[model samples]
Target: MLLVIGPGAVGTVLAGYLSAAGRSVRLLCPESALPALSAADEIVIDRVTGGPPLRAPKPLLTTTVNPERVTQIFICVKQPDLESVCDLIPPALPPSVPLVSMLNAPSAVHRLRERFPQHTALPASVLFNAQLLEPFRARVTTVPRIQLPFEHRQVVESFAGTGIRPVRAFGEASAWGKLLLNLSNAIAAVTHSTFRDILSNPLLRASYADLLDEAIRVLRAARIPFRAPLPVSLSAYQMMMRHAGALPWWLARWKWRLAEGAYPSMVSDIAHGRPTEADALNGEIVRVAARAGVDAPLNAKMVTLVEQVGAQRPPRYLSPAELRSALGHHLQT
Candidate 1:
């Protein structure tokens, strides 16, 4: 049995897919909100690519649980709530029950590994983007994809039949690869635009490239082997940034198609006046760079701007000129 904790976008989408695929799934949500979703399926996934939508059968929702019944558990809560959620789960769970973390921040993996040493823990990175639009309804802007960086290949293989294809990562290198892609999430959230829009804007594109370049430098300094896959190579991306204005229309469209959709989780949070995972995404880069004695002014400034935006302060939109001014001499070539 698969246990999906937290009924947010990530958890609901996973539950809907797995349950629709004939897997027994249970949703564990907070008690206060349980009654509101008692009769609901708890998950509705609308595939953006015109694929058939998936709706989970009536979910088994409960606040408390006997973890022994859960053969596998997916932690889907936000980074800030991870520790509290983990603490709520009964300690009776068997030592063998694998706990997979589908979070954007890589630091959560390390924290969970340390806190739950007795249980088999697998640190996973989710590749898909989804949004919870309404009660039990999840708009899946991208297909469900996950990359698991763990030593147990069989554990990942076990998920093959469940539609959640798990890519096996040989080592921590895969973790860094996932983190590299996450750079765009914070960028999209701050700009309040789609991936297409974010990439289309030359200035925004450069800012994103600066963030990724700094991230790569930090990873390299930490002795982590992280590299982007073919066609999407880090070097190629940087080169594209240099000639973004010169790229042919068709070619640029092709590239956007390959890139993931604008991050819906961030969009939903921003629209609803909730705090975003900026600290987990770009802020994490700033924190790591500080420890490595590396400079990441672009990422730092972006983080500051995002935090300010999330605070509901004035100047909601930063114009290109404003962004240039904020970036200062860095924009001067």
Candidate 2:
């Protein structure tokens, strides 16, 4: 049996896919998530790129974990929820079950491993774009694929017919690659902009490009392997960064299609009055850079912006220009 924790877009959508693949799955969520979840035994899976909608039905639902019955576990909660969930997770899983995490940052797996030393923890980079339209309804706003830690053929084959594709990776390279792309997550949240808007705007694009570049520098200085999981290569990515404000036509067009119907997770967190993962995403870059004796002023500035905005009772609003000015001051300092 497959066990999924959390009821966010990723977890909710994953449970539907596993059920569609003929796997016995149980989704464990909090009491607040039950009303909408129990409304129906099936979830609507809409394919935005190009496909008909399908229903994944009858996934077992529960609020508690049954360790013995669970064969595998997938952790799909946001980073801010990690600490609170950590204590409740370790005791519920047997040592033999492989724990797959779809968190944004690679360092999250290390924390999970420390908490659940008896189990095998693997970091899976989520490449799909999904949005929650309603309490129980979620849809794939873009393509769906996941980069797993290693080439486990059986694991890869299990998702063969399903729409969600799985790719095998090595040495945590995929996680770092995904992290580079996700540097914009906080930017999207902070500016209250859509994904396309974030990339299309010169200021937002330039800010994100610099943040990604800083992360790459830190990783290189730390002697960590960095790879681009996207179709682009390392040199090509660096070249693209150079012309950050003026993006290639093809890339910009491709991004809009995927981003049109989606919003960043942190944005959703802001909307629902939940804590955002600013610290885990951009903050992770700052932490890693400090350890490598490098200063990432751009990312450090973003972390502060997110914290300030997130603390406001009514989410603090900041224009892109204001954000750029804030970043500029840090760069000058």
Candidate 3:
């Protein structure tokens, strides 16, 4: 049996879809969420790319994880919630059951390894975003996919026909590479712009470029490998961020395709008065830059901005120009 922890957007979508694919699955949600999810008895995945909505059979929803029956565990939670959530599960879970960390934080697997010292906590990068429009419905703008370490190949059989592809790669490198794109999530959250707005608008793209470049520079200085999340090379993806304005629409059409009413997950958290994962995503760059004896002020500033917004409800959203200014002198006036 597959035990998917959390009934947040990612958890519900994955557990629901896997169950739809005829896999044995269960959803471990917070105590407060149990009632609503239990009442729904299923989740609806509305695909922005078009087609009928996917109705995922409700997997067994519960507040507690029965380690005895769980064959594998997929942890789908924000970075700030990691330790607290892990504390809810029994430490006696079988050592053979791999703990898949499908988190935006690049270092989540390392953190998971620390917490579950005896278990194999494999790192996975969620290559798609699913937004929870309501209690039991998630919207997928992009085709849902996940990137896993080569070591995760053993569990690939569990994903068979689940509509979620498990692409194998060097986990650490892929996580960092994905972080480069995720930096924009904080940008969208702070500016109150849709993910599409960040890429489509020149000023927003420039601000995003500034953040990406800063993180990229820090990684290069530290000699950290930046393997592409997909088959494309890091240089190619960077080019898309840095010079997207000069390129034709076709050159960047894929970006638009995947972003439908898409704001970063942090946007929702901020809107609803919850913590964001700015620390795990942008904060990783700041920590690495410190270790490497480099400056990552832009990423650091973003971490502050995201935290502030989440703390103060009804945030006064920053305009693109203001955000670019906050980032520093990287843009023209």
- Among all candidates shown, the one with the greatest TM-score: 3
Tens-digit lDDT track of model 2 for 121-196: 8888888878877755788876788787645554556567776877777658778888888888888888888777
Which ten residues in a row are the worst by lDDT in model 1?
A: 248-257
TM-score of each: 0.88, 0.92, 0.93
lDDT of 1 by residue, 1-333 (tens): 788888898888888878777878888898877776775644677876566677668567767667668888888988888888778767788888887878777787788778888987776777667777665788776546677754676457556676666765645566667777667666666667676655667776666667777778777776667644224666877778657553522353453232344454775566667777778877877787788787667777877877776677432756645665676655324
Each candidate: what lDDT? 0.70, 0.77, 0.80
C-alpha lDDT (0 to 100) for residue 256 of candidate 1: 28
lDDT (Cα) of model 3: 0.80
Cα misplacement distance, residue 290 of candidate 1 (Å) = 2.0
lDDT of 3 at 236: 69
Task: Write one digit per residue (lDDT tens) for candidate 3, span 166-232.
Answer: 7776858888888888898998888888866887788888778888888989999999987756445
Runs with alpha carbons beyond 4 Å of true place in candidate 2? 90-92, 244-249, 252-257
Once all C-alphas are superposed, what RMSD does model 1 give against the true structure? 3.0
By descending lDDT, how would the candidates be arranged?
A: 3, 2, 1
Question: What are the runs in model 1 whose C-alpha is more than 4 Å off?
Answer: 39-42, 150-154, 229-231, 244-261, 313-315, 329-333
Q: In model 3, how many backbone clashes occur?
A: 0
Judged by lDDT against the true structure, how good is candidate 2? 0.77
> Which ten contiguous residues of candidate 2 have the minimum total lDDT?
248-257
**Lowest-sum lDDT 10-residue window in model 3:** 247-256
TM-score order of candidates, top first: 3, 2, 1
